[model samples]
Structures are given as structure tokens and as C-alpha cells.
Target: MDNLLSSYSPDFPVASDGTQTFDRDALQERIARVRTALTTRRNPHGAVAILADNSPDWLAVDLATAQLGLTLVPLPLFFTPAQWVHVLAQSGATALFCAQPQQGAALGFSAMTDYGGGLLLCEAPARGGPLPLPGARKITFTSGTTSVPKGVCLTSEQQWEVAHALHRGVSGLGIKRHLCLLPFAVLLENIAGAYTALLSGATMICPPLAETGLQGASGFDPQVCLAAIERYQAQSIILLPQMLQALVAATKPGDARLACLRFVAVGGARTPPRLIELARMHGLPVFEGYGLSECSSVVALNLPGAERIGSVGRVLPHRSVRIAGDGEIEVRGNLGHYLGEAPAPDAWLATGDLGHIDADGFLYIEGRKKDILITGFGRNVSPEWPETALLGTGAVAQAVVVGDGMPFLSALIVPATAAIDAAQIAAAVGLANRDLPDYAQIRRWILVAPFTPANGHATANGRPRRQLIQQHYAQQIASLYDTTEHIA
Candidate 1:
């Protein structure tokens, strides 16, 4: 069990301060100090809830927790105060690590730290000990069907297997300098952007907030991300589908800023093949991937040399996958424990996703098993398929279809660019309908605002919170069926 920190040398690791480059040796040393504090306190099996934004200190504390064998719960910075309180209490965390003093004080955790108290508080130290190579590790609290959220437990061994698989799959591309666009709190980015980079001996660059494309009123600036790529000379990066779309739209032909880029891995939602083709035509390398929180991030990915259009690529070497009789994707190998429950020794885990393997072993993801829309005529329609086709028209920003109880499917579309009028959307929908069966066609639609994470309609990685969005716009959807509204 070699510790994660011990793998890296004591020599100064590079860090960005927006202007000058700084060494991370002090950060490593701070981590070591934190580990000592935890050991001296002798609180085994205690849970620590980390309430912090992305920063050097956050990484240090994470490494420290690994060294100390303490369960670490990384809380989302975007959560409301009441949501934070609820999660902290439900997690039964014995200590709180606050990046902001106000956060701790507001929750009354600051006083607990002062009074020989229930909660211990300390600034994340810079140095830490070596992390164990591979063993059981805990990551909890995943977004679930209910508001309470669910905790997913993954062992270090499971994470290592995934990292190794990804490293092998993308080996043909040579070494890569990965720009981490997704938040580190996400398991997908944490393992893929951090662990996988470490496994591949690649440079893992974390851009400053200003350089991360998350600026201005719209929240993320695609231009800043492109500029950072040029500045850092980054060869690879991870993006959600929405971010990828924005980058594609923002980029122009002959943009030398992307000349050095080797691959842009897009996941967290279904990606349209037309979008991928558009990116490739513009000299961008966008590879699509698929996975879930239970799989330690990526289960399948399209790599540089081995890519299949309209597919999520072949399964990684470290895992085994099979399509059930009903088209559900069931997986096994490198399996881990479920949070709040004991680990299962079975060889298979139901992925709850529906997809089929192509003749060449590529995976074509149809949609979520839970989200299949059944028409009144008994035809099965996966909204993702139609949605992908709709997005291909380049006019629709977001589309969600509902037809579970209705005779005909209906869509709620978010038009791209304010200038694009309803006529443009109708034309796109008409084009999409030309290729779909009569039962699968969108009989009607309602224009709406784009779903976003800030508004709770999307996940951190940009996946649609389908049920939430449906609930929020239930009235609008109902109005689409009104007699006054007409559908061509």
C-alpha cells in the first residue's frame, strides 16, 4: 500500500497562481502536518467533511486523508446552507475542514473545534506522507433519485483498475498534458484527470478559475478555455457535452490555438455524432466516453486511434461487459463496495443503462434504462436518440421528450442563441422527425431556457436532472397539449 503522495518526489511540483509559477513542496509539507495531527488525535474511522472550493489546499487535505486512512467526504461548494447542514449531519462526520471560516462559523462547527469539541479544525497543511498503493478507500454522497442523495463507495483498488484501463486504452496517443475542466470533486474528473494522469506519467494542469471558461454572466466563457489551452500548450482536456458544444461554436476554422490539442474527451451525457464530426472538421479531437459514479468514472471511451462514430468506444481491458436480453448493460470486474452497505462479491453489477455492442465490439448507448419512453402504440423510444438527432441540427441547445402516458411524444427545446426564432427550432424538429418513426416523432414542443447547473436543472457535469426539470416545467409542458396550441 504505497501512499499517493509518496509516489511523487519531494522536488517542487508546479502550481499556477494566475501570473507566476509556484512550487507545491510547501503544500506537500502541509499535508504531512495534517496527517500528523490526525494520527496524534488517534481518531480512527472518523469521517471528515471537506467544505471547500477547488484550490491547492483542497488537494493537500485530500492527500492527507488518504495517508491517514480517514474517510473523506468532499461536499459540493454549490450546495445551499441547509443542504450542507443536512449532508453533514447525515454523513455523521466527526470533523469539518473548511476552506472558508464563515462556512464553519455559520454551521456552529467553529465553536465545536474550539471547546475541546466534537469537531476538530485546522488549516490544510502543505506536506503529507505517502499514500497506500491500493486498498479500500471511501467516497460517499452521490446525487440520487431523492433529494437526500446516495453515497457510492469505491475502493482504491477499483480506482487503480480504472486508471490502468484508461492508460492502456489511450496509450497510442503518446503522453498528454491534460487540462482539468471539470471540478475535482466529481469522481469522473478526480480519477480520470488526476489518478489516470499519475498512472500515465502525464502532466496534470489545473487552470485558474479565470482561465477555466467559468466567468461572466453566463457562468462559463468558452474563449477563456481556448486561450488557456494555447497558453498552457495543453494537448488534452475533459469536457461535458454542453461545454464541448460551446467550444465547437466558439472555435473558428484555422484557429491555431487548437493545433497542439490531441484529444478532448467528452462525457457525462449523450453526444451527437454530428457534433463529433463538426469538431473533427475544425481540427479538434473530441472523443466520446460513458460511465457512472458506481464505475469509478469511465467504463467505456473512444480513444485517439480506436474510434467508432455513434458509439462510446469499446469496453476497457480491465472490465467485462455484457448486454442483457432486454438491452441493459451489465458489467463486472474491478467491482467495489456500495456506500453504507457491505461490498458484494458477485461478478456482475447492473449498470441500469441500455445499450448494444456493435459487430466490431464498440458500444452504442441507446439511453438510460429508466428513461425509455413507451408510446401508446407500444413502440420503445429512447429520448437520447431523438435528442441527439435534434442537437445535430445546430439550432436546438437542449431537448427533453416526454411520452410515457401520451399517444405522441412531445419535446421541450432550449434554442441556441437568442436570435434563433421559433421557426428555426420547428425546422430543426421537422428535420429530426423525417428520420424517426411516426410513433417516435415529437408531436409538439415548448421553447424554454437552457438547463444549467446554477439553476439545479443539470448535474455538475452537465447531465440533465430529468425529473427535476420535468417538475419545474410541468405547467409549461401541460400547456403544449392545450387546444389553443397547434403542432404541425
Candidate 2:
């Protein structure tokens, strides 16, 4: 990590958070300050948790922890207080840095010294137990389908390899300025955005989430985001598929506002090919990629000259991917282990995602392995296939297909805009159904409110929590399969 940071020139601008910019020398000075503070107030567990917003100080603390050999646990701002409690308890975090000291105090932490950057260092009593992570440099909690998020332990070497690979992957685009759209706590932005930008000698423009037009977990304002891009002249940025959709909808054909973007890597969910097409039509340089937290963020990505629509593109240099016998995508290379579990003896990490690598080496994700639905007629269908088809239609904002053992599939649809009526959504569904087989078509669907982290239907990164959605709309879903009739 030190070597990677030292490779760049001292005067290169590394980080900015709207209010302050950190060139390499300034960044190093901050890191040194953080390191000194940690050294003086070291906890018994040697673990520190950060619950602040995106800022240059966040990166400074992260680098300082790496140098001090302390495990860094990033607390997501979108997570509920209950979820935060669960993470602090499980990860054995003995120190915390957050803007709200009272909140930290409520979470078993007492106010300690200040961290000098809108964060207060707090101390917690170490629990009496054998620590789960012996060598983990960072423990990132993933908001899965359940209420309690899972922590994935990563070594410094594993993270650096991914960062270096990302730098190599997008270096050709000459992206010297990157705007961070997601939270710094997200592993994708932490490694693939911050670390990669530093490695590539690029400036990381990390304005607050509100400034970047993000609200809580799933809310976004595309116009505000575009304004930030224009203000920063961001040459590159990362986004979720839904964010891409909003931006594409907000922009017109040959929109000059996004002219500064040379690369826009979209992931965190399956991107419907039609959204990519729509983005291209608007002169947005959008590319789809695939990854999970277990593989340290990115596994494969589509690049400029080697573009393949619908596919997530080839695997990164640091990782190898293969489809399991049951079609689960398994990745090998420096994979992180889940906290409290023994490290896998094997090199391969079984990503719950189901995908296939084609003859040309482009990787295509179908859906989740457990999400595949087996109909009453014994036909197996991956929900993402029809969901993608549904999203491809510009009218449908979000689609969740359910019918694990029913006669036909039904969906919970969210319209692209409140103005789009049922008739328009029905027309969109019919158009999407034309390309699907009879068995895979959405036979019945009901329009519902948008899924978001606050609503408990979506993860922080905007991926739908299937189990929660099913439970929340159980009666609505039941009504869809009540009859033998098909909406189509």
C-alpha cells in the first residue's frame, strides 16, 4: 500500500470533497496525522470503525489504518441503527469515528479524542471473545437479502491487486478526473474508485452524497448529478444501473452536459441492454460491468474498443471466472473470506450469481442462483432475464419477477415516472414480452412504489432484496396468481 501511494508524484492531486482538495503531499500529511492519533489512542482490539460521509479525511483514515496495521470497518450511513449495532457487535470494533458522537455513545462507544475532520473518535469496550479476523486489513459489511448485513474480510494485498487491475483496465481512456457517485463505504467505490484513481494518478472528486444528488440509499436526482459532473468536469464516474437509467432519461440526444465523461462504468445490478442503448443514444459513454463484494468489487468489465452489449465483458487480470456445474459464477484469486468463518482452503469463491462466459470470453450474468424460479410446469427461469426485458422498456422503472412454483410468472413493477399510467406500463410490458418465450413472460403484474433502502425493499447499492419484497407484497403477489388468466 505504501509502495502504491509512493509511486505517484508528490504534487499530484489525489482527493477532493467539495470543500477541500488533497494533493499527494497534503494527503500524506493527513495520513501521518491520523497515524499519530491512532498510535496514541490504540485500542485493544486494534479495530477502528468509521461512520462518516465521503470526504478526503475518510481516505486519510483508511490509509492510516493500513499503515498502523489496524483493521478498518466502514459503517454505511444508509444502514439502520439496528444494523449498525449488529455490525459493531460482530466486527468487534473498539474505536469509532463519526460525526454524531451521541449516536456512537448510544452504540456502546464513549466520546474520546477528536479526529480533526468533522469526526469524533470514540472508544468502545472490547468484547470477551476470540477475534474472527486475524489478518484482515478491512472488513466491509454487505447488505444482502437479510436484515443483518454480512462482513467480508479483506487483506491489503487483495484490495491493492484489484485497484491495480482497475487502473490497468481503464487507464487507456485517460480518465484523469473521477466523480464518486456512491458512498465511500461501498467496496466498489472504496477500491475501484478511490484506490484505482490514486494508482492511476487521477483526482477523486468526492462531493457529499447530497451534492452528488443521492438521498439515503436509492433516491437520486439526475439533474443535480449532471450539474456536479459539469462543475467538476469529471472524465469518469461509476454508477448503479438505476442511476444510469435516471441520467439517460434526464438527458437529451447529444446532450453536451455529459460531454466530459469518457467512461461511465455501471454495475451493482444487472443493467438491461436497452438502458445502455438509450444511454448511447444520448451520447453518454456508458459501460456495464459485473462484480460482488466477495470478489473484492469487480470481476469483469466492458471497455471502450472491446465493447460487448449485454455482456459484463472479460474478467480482470487479477481474477479468473468460471461457471459452476449448477451455473453459479465462481471467481478465483485473492478472494475475501466472510468474518468469523475459516478461510476457504480452495482459491475459488462461489459467487451466488449465475452467469456464463461465451466463446469470445465475454461474461453474461443471468441472475442469482437461488433466484431461479421453477414453475408449476417444471420450467426453470431466471428472474433477471424477464426483469431485464421489463426494464428495457422505458416505461418500467423497476421490475421484480416472482412465481417460484406457480403456473406463470408475475411481477411487481415501478413505473419510470409518476406520469406514466397503467396503460403505458401495460404497453411496455407487452413490448418486452414479445421477445421472451411463453414460459418466461410476466403473466401478471401490479404497479407498486419504488424499492429503496429506507423502504426495506432494496439494498444500499439499489439491488432489490427479493425476500423482503416478496414478504412485503405477499398479498399483492398472491392476488396475481389467484386466477388461471394471463395478462398477456
Candidate 3:
């Protein structure tokens, strides 16, 4: 508690909506009330599922769960009814707290009473018993790229460690306002954005993602997002790679809407170096970084005055990193808890990612080891490298690079706008291809409709589900060799 609360006073703003603002004093009091309510109304150690949006009420529940030392399960709004059932059952969550009672009804939940601030506490029959996590205070579900999402158990102690480290990591940057772009359920924003803002004495803006031009998991209006930043005068924000690209495209030369931004941290995917450079050219203050759920949230970051163009910056001082002989990044210290059953506690976790640390200690990620594509020529290519390059062109909104058993590479692209012509896309792909080697270049290409989470083509956090991508475009991928390019 001290690590997160020590920097703020009674009156400092903690979180806000368009109509209301909650300060530190209000947060503390509300946390206490919720803690008392939970203790009086629910089982001591049983888990509670939070099915809500970004609002002051959600933070109160989050802090209350930590304070009461109870288990919390955050259910993503983007998840389907069946996925929600699985998460709630896996976590043994009997209490469902949500902003809209209708949402609960859609998931077979009936209202018990209002939990206050437009939240309802409903009861559900448990499917599985309480999980056997001894010290776990929260269970965050993975993005479930190709399958059902798994739970990741975590202790408040581990979460605070990351938050405190992040506060210190970006020290002296004068970051006073932080706008939460991703859903609060996403661990990246949960731990790094909200928690670190409190620890750093910064105000947090938790407006509904829709208000900022985010529609579900697929639609984004970058102009609306920029307006929110301007309206709030936000100093810093957390962004995914795709979001950064759109924001960069939305900004014009000498655009005053971005003048108040002091920092923009991009992650949640491998960022192309060209995108970072483009952002700088357009005067958007963006930096790239990396992390996974297992390592809490943020393990490495690129901050102002200490940034590398293609690196995820230095490993955070709180954790240590060493590259494996096979080129995987190995992490040591406080990797946090796991779900279902955790792997045996060990000194280091091999991150399934393949990367190397530079002489300057900056970590440069190539791609996921499991997702590497093997061409017919026996050349190994990580799709992210080329996919990132394609996205950086500013002509395409989405790209999926795959050529797994083929002689050469092929890509499925979604134009950023309807105004973008085939010639522009062709030119963009040609430009992006210049940075790649022969075997990894797109030999045949197809342009398809946008891939989005709602369409099962992307995960909740904006990552492409490769199998799903391949399945949806199976005919196009198959015809690429024969027809060249159709509506593809």
C-alpha cells in the first residue's frame, strides 16, 4: 500500500470520468467501504469477478480486493459468453460485479443488489472449487491467441514491485497525467498504467475506451483518441503498436493537439523501428518497450533521453535478464504466479521469445519462437519482423505474414483507409520489403478486410491469431501462387 499510496495526498486526483473525478482521499475511503462490504457479504477467501469498464468504481474494487487479501478475477469485456464462463469457473468466482446488470443477465447472472457507483453484485453457482493459490490476490487471464485464455495468479506484493519500479524507471520525466487507452483488465494497463500513476503522483484518466474512439477490439478512431488527450491535457499515455501508428497518421505538421503530450509508451507487440522514426518525424513523442504477463506487466521500457531506435530499452532495474544459448531471453526474479497449476518455482523463466541484449544492455526482440515461419528454402523468419515493417508503411492498418511451408512469403493486408489505392499499398509493401532479406520478402500478396478481435482474427489485446488468420484467408493464401492478387 505504501509503495502505491506514499506519493499522493488526500486531495490529489486518482481517476476520472467525463462527469466525475475521484481523488486519493475518496479512493481510500471507498476502498475501505468496499472492503467492509465484501467482508460482511461474502466468503473470506473466495474470489470475486469484476466485469466492468474503466471507471472510479473499478479501481475501488481493485484496491479493496488487494486490501482485504482476497482473490480477484478481471473478466475482459471483449470475451465471449463461453469464455467468460470458463474464466469465472476456473477462478472459482461466485461473485460477479459489473457496471450493467444487463451484461450480467447475458452471462446468466441475476442481481442481488447494487454495489454502488453503477455496479451490481450478483451471485452465480460455482462450477469449480476455489483455486489452490496460496498467496495469490488476483487472477489475470491470458490473451488466448489460439485457444482459451489461461489464468495468471499474482500477489499484490509482486504487482506493487513492478509499479514502484516503473515509477522510478520513468523518474524526472514530469509525467503528471496518464490516459488509460487499453482496457483496465489488460495486465499491461492494470499494473503499469493505473498502479504506476498512483505511485508516481499522477492523475489517471479512465474514460470508457469507446469515448476515445476504440470500438470493441477492432475499430479505432485515432482522431477521437487525440481529442481526449488534448481535452485532458494528458502528459503521458500507454499505447499498443497499432494505436501508435494510427495516432501518428492522425497528427499533422505542427498539430497542437499533441503539443501537451510529454511521453507515449508503445508495447503489447513488437514495434517496427520505422514507426518510431515516423512518429518522431510527425512530432509524436512515442517510445517502444516490451513485457509479458508472466513478468508482471512491463520488464523493459524506452524512455526519453535514454532510448534506442530498435531496442525495447534496458531491462528494468527490478528484474535481471540473460539470453539463453538458443537465443531466448531468460528472466530471473519475481516472475509472479501462474494459473491452473504453476510451473515449479525456479530462479529463471525462459520467455518463449527469441531476442538478444545489445552491448548497451538494450533488449531487441525478434519474434515469438513458437510462431516462427519456416520457408521451403529452410529459412527461418519471425512474422512480426516483416509484419511490423509492413504496418510501419502508414498505408496498411493490419498485416499477417505467413509462408510456413512455401517457397517464399505472402502477406494479407488491410488498407488503413478506403482512400488508400492499390498502387499506394503496392508502393508501401515495396518500401517495407527493402528492409528485409530475399527469402523473407513478400513474393505474393493479398489485401483483405480488417482483422479484428470481434471477428476472431485478433486477440483481446490486438494480437493476430495466426491459425485463425490462416483459416479465414485459406483460399486466398492458396490462390496467391496461381492468381497473383484478387480481392485478396
Candidate 4:
């Protein structure tokens, strides 16, 4: 009956099987043990690299690192072996932890510890207990889908501030349950899904990642996601725009399977209004949110109490936001300093995103500032707007618009189904053109193969890696305008 932050009961139960709950006392003990081990080795300043799937042990390690006052770097689960090496070296992680030693050994780290089957057991140290160093100096490697990935350093205080802001933002809501769909390695999910849920005394239900309605090659099966929702009776969940679209496609009209659900937050990219409408019609309360990694995951979210259809919702209570003269979103209050050095007083984090706020205070995200295309005739265009239009046609699975430094805009599209012919794609393009101006319209397009996470064409959160996609299909994109008839 104790409040979430008040008790700090290390013995509190985390999971249950209808009969009994799994206590977290052992996890706290493991943290004590790890602290002892690190102190005995005189390596408190060293960084610990954790490469493991989501499980009880992962939480244990995270909590343990926090208790020990040691730096923790969570390695992405989907990274290639080469990427793993790059992150390990770039992060300067001295110790590596994994569920599988063989895989850890392959990564070629100096020291490796195998905590088998996602369970770690260690004895508490007598002398070296917890440290008062505030919290972790966490470093998360960027998903270098387009360019080289950089290490984003965040302090524990900063992370905790973000969690607190989210807690304050949603505090009025009653006790809720959160179903985590994205991988824990993703900062958005880690902070918002896990930390915010913890702050709210909410139960965090993590179904298998593959069954969570994610739409990429590495995404979850929509059917499995629905079944998990029914089994757990999840009240709230998170999804990317693509996953929301997929769920809308998979479910029948007026399906009551998700009747228990209250809120389904969709982000990581723009959510089409049509998809939101479909999800609402299918009995899912989908709310679109807007955020980026630099802002500690969430700056604005549409709450159930103050819902809006197309906007990402009002700015959270602790945050201050404004649009710059150049159309960039500038955010200020309740912000944290970057890891390495203190931020300046006027440190207005320029969210490379461009959007406008309406008189009613709802945020309508236009598109990425860098992704905005301007034609040779001097017309501004947001590729995402047109891409969303193309996707709503149902035949196009994905669309990327290219027009920067070009005479006119062109598009590269992927079909929704393997059997979908070129004519169908063209028809979708035609529909998209109807809503666009001549300068912003796609004059030429090519049917490209499916975008996949393995190739780095899409982010782990399912947003298209526009720069990477442009690089991957550079030749094809150029070929689109190679024909004399298509050239302006």
C-alpha cells in the first residue's frame, strides 16, 4: 500500500503468475554484490557495458549500476557485431555483461561476465556499500543508420528529471498498467515506458518484443500483440506510427478485444490522421506524441484528459516551448545539462523538428527541418506530409521524397504487399499528387525493395532513416530524373 518512491522496498514484487509475485529483494542484493565486486577490483571509475535482452536481470544490472555509482552503457540488442565493437570502444566500457558469454566473447571485450538465463546471483560486499554519486553517467550510442553513430551522454540527474517531469505531467491519472512495445535499449522506451511507469506505481508489462505490433523486419507480430493485450489486460501502451497503422490494418472494425485499454501513445515519427481515425474506430485510444532523444524522450504528449486528434498534445507542465523565427522548435525549462559539460543558461535545445502550435495549445508537427525539400523553382515542401498522403492510399507501404537541390520532387516507394503491382503504386502516387502542389508533387518515382532494420534504412523505433535511405538508394534516386522527359 506504500507509494512508489516512498518505500524503495528492494523486496517488492515485480512479476506474478496469478499465484505468487517475484520479489525484487534478490535484485537489490545483486546490486550490493556488484558494488562489492567493483570496489574490490578498484574499478569504480570504469564503465560497465550491458548487452542483453529485456528481462529481470537487465533491470537488476541497471539498478545495480545505479547503486554502485558506476557508469552504465546499454548496448543495443539489434546492433551488428561490428557496431557492437564500435560502441564498446567508443563508450570506453571497461567491463562487459551479457546473458551469453559466447556472444560477448565474439564482441572482443577485455573482460566478460556471463549472467546465465537472465538471472544473476552475487553476494553483497561487507564494506563497499552504495555510493552517493547521485546516479549513472549513462551513454547511449546513436543508431547510425545514416551517418556515424555518436555517444549521447546523459547524467543520472538529467534522466531522473525527465522521469519526474513525465510523472508530474500524468500524475492526475489513476493507477495504470503500461505495456512496453519498444526494446528497453531505446531511450524513449527506457525513460518513458519504464521510468515513468515506475514513478506512477504502474505495472510495466513487457510482452515479447516480436509480438508487439512493431512493423519493421525486427517488429512484433500484430496478432501476438493483440493476444498479449488480452492476456495481460494492458491499460496503456506505446507504439510508433507504423505499428499503429499495422494494428489498424490487422484488426476488424469495432473489435472489442482492446476494450480494457485506455491510452495508446504513438510517436517516433508522424502519425497520419487517417491512421488515428482508424485506430479510434477500432476501439483503441491512440494519442500522438512528439519528442526526440535530446529532450530525454518526451516534451509533449496528448493526455487522455486533454486529447486532440492531429496534434502531439500540449507541452508537459515542467517544460517551456516556443517556435523560433526560422521555424525550429525551441525548448527551455526543466531541462538537464549534457553529460560531459554543463549547458549554457540560454541553452534552448533546437529540436531539428519544425512545427507550429495552435491557439488551443495543441502541437502540430510538420516535419524534420533537415528533411524539408526545396525545389529549383524555390518552393518549400515537407516530404513527410506527402509521404503520409501516399501511405494513406493503402497500396504504398513506405514513401521517401527527394527534391533538395533538384528541379522537382521525386519519390521512392515500397509496396504494401508483394502482389501489389506497379499500377497500384502509381495509383497511390496519383492520389498523393492530388493533395500536393505541382512543385511539391512527385514527378518521378521508382518501386524500391522493402526497408529493413538490418540495412539501417529504418530506426529501431520504426522511423525511416531518411539520410540512410537516401544513401542506400542514391543511384536509383538519381536515375529517377535521368530521363529527359522527367527533367524540368
Candidate number of the best lDDT: 2
Clashing pairs in 4: 210-220
TM-score of each: 0.88, 0.96, 0.95, 0.86
Cand. 4 TM to true fold: 0.86
Q: Flag regions of model 2 displaced more than 4 Å.
A: 7-11, 42-45, 126-132, 483-488
Which structure among the candidates has the greatest TM-score?
2
* Alpha-carbon runs more than 4 Å astray in model 3: 2-6, 125-128, 343-345, 483-488
Cα lDDT computed for each candidate against the true fold: 0.72, 0.86, 0.82, 0.70
- Full ranking by TM-score: 2, 3, 1, 4
Over 1-488, each residue of candidate 2 has an lDDT whose tens digit, in order, gives 67656755777778888888888888888888788778777564468899988988888889889887889999999999999988888888888888787878888888577856556778876554336577799999987887889999988888888888888888898888989999999999998899998888889999788999897767899999999999999998999988898898899998888988999999999999999999988978988888878777888999888779999989998788889999998898878899988776248888898889899999999999988899999999999999999999888889999999998899999999889998998899899999899999988889999999998998877778999899989998898878665654
Give a tens-digit lDDT track for model 4, residues 13-37: 5533223334555445555556555
Cα displacement (Å) at residue 432, model 2: 0.4
Per-residue lDDT for 376 in model 3?
90
- Alpha-carbon deviation at 199 in model 3, angstroms: 0.6
Q: What digit string (tens of lDDT, one per residue) describes model 1 on residues 1-488? A: 33444444565353333443324465556666666655654344466668764455555566677766677767776555666666666655656676556777676555323312112363222213222112446565565444555666677677778878887776677655677776667777777776776666565677545567864213667888888888888877888877777787888776898898887888888898988898887778889999877778898999877889789998887778899999999988767655556667356888878999988889989988999988778888888888888887778878888877677888988886778898989999999988787888888988878776567776666667789989998897777765566764
Q: How far is 125's C-alpha from truth in model 4 (Å)?
A: 22
TM-score of 1: 0.88
Cα lDDT of model 3 by residue, 366-439, tens digit? 88888899999899999988888888788988899988988888899988789998889888889898999998
